[model samples]
Target: MNQTQQMNNDAVVEVLNASGASDIVLVCEHASAFIPTALNDLGLSAEARHSHAAWDPGAKAVACEMARQLDAPLVASKVSRLVYDCNRPPDAPSAMPERSEVFDIPGNKKLTRNDRETRVARYYTPFHDRLKQVLSTKPDPVVVTIHSFTPIYQGIQREVEVGILYDQDTRLADAMLEVETGTFVTRRNDPYGPADGVTHTLKEHALPQGRRNVMIEIRNDLIETADAQTSLAIQMSRWVADAVTQSKDISCRV
Candidate 1:
């Protein structure tokens, strides 16, 4: 973590169901569209302020619901990705993307090294630090990160509704992909993959520790409505719970 500028006192992360005993920890990297008071909307247009470029539209809702259903602790970032992408490392260009899809982030444009380091310290560091803290509490942990992708990106239309993404360790991803996806066109690493740098959260938080981890991507269009979010969450809860159970059973038998 780079630290040229002093970090802010604002809370950059949220941990829900902190006391839950479940062996799972949920993470939502693009949970909020809240840019800090200092960034002035990250020089975003009125439309871009809350666009998919800023945050995953319904990721937090679904994550919260899944946390409730599974009685798991969720560590979610509270700031917009335009400020600093919590899932991305400071060195990654996408960590402070100047361009997202069709929107241009004027605030992130022409950033200096110090400026990038400051944002990393203020947003990225604390977010993952708290995540590490949350993970430290669990005896046996299964890391699950929640995200939502756009139905259309740039000029292409994406057909995959759910994506199970992973890096090196695919225990959870393998089991999760095996679970029934109902009507969702769930696939292994569709839309985005490890090559796309979408699995930084899994790589940083789960892989080195040898924990079972999977990143779940729900198509934003499917989770637009509150009811739709809840309905999808119910189905997702089953997928996750069943997968975790299967993993534990296999481990015990081994």
Candidate 2:
């Protein structure tokens, strides 16, 4: 395999490694450190939303560890979420963010259809296609997309340790509640809502199939450290394993 193929064949995105344990398939659409070379930082300062937009700072570590522990496959994006959010639909505003928090991305503003197509062809399409390909190989696997949120966003304090986001898959959500019950304090879609469409991966693939699926959001502050990442991965792995067991009755809608 060539370099690109080698990378793809090995790591899940540019970060996560596909697991070989459970039937669960994990996705981290924001796991990346890449800012497209053509955009040249998208006209923002090095510190301005770079870490957040480029990647979920600390999420990849936990995601990688989770893949390892669960022995499940993962499909993640190699490009920055700011370039084109893999979780969002092709037309969502955040799908091509002009302003993420404090930084204004000039390159993303007033995108032509061709420009949009370039990003889609380059990043978005490949990611989703890979996801579909992975799922096709697995049989009714529980889809779990991992993401991390800033501890504080736009001056708002987010207190939830984890957020279980889903539109319809109550099985995995209920299982998560049972696992983390009274312990870690998981919010049922507190930080963000599914209607926003920023997290469309679960919606597009997971929920439609009536598969046991949930997007787990860990506070970025909690998993930035290696020890914390490992701990969180182990905890999440147990819940995922439980959810997999519980999902035996889930009929695929695909």
Top candidate by TM-score: 1
TM-score of 2: 0.89
lDDT (10s digit) by residue, model 2, range 1-254: 37985554343344245436576888888887577677777776777646675578777788889889888777777777787788888877788888877678887899999989877767776677778777777776678889988888888888898888877567777667766645576888868767756458877777766667888888898887899999989988887787667656755543
Candidate 1, residues 1-254, lDDT tens digits: the string is 33533234236888899987898999999999998888888788878987999999999999999999999999988899889999888999999999998898999999999999988878898888889989999888899999999998878899899998888887777788777656689889888899999889888888788788889999999999999999999889989999887776443210
Q: What TM-score does candidate 1 reach? A: 0.93
Where is model 1 more than 4 Å wrong at Cα?
Answer: 1-10, 249-254
Question: Residue 242: error of model 1 in Å?
Answer: 0.4
For model 2, what is the error of residue 140's alpha carbon versus the real structure, in angstroms, after optimal superposition? 1.7
TM-score against native, each model: 0.93, 0.89
lDDT accuracy of residue 237 in candidate 2: 89
Q: What's the distance in Å from true for residue 102, model 2?
A: 1.9
Clash count, predicted structure 2? 3
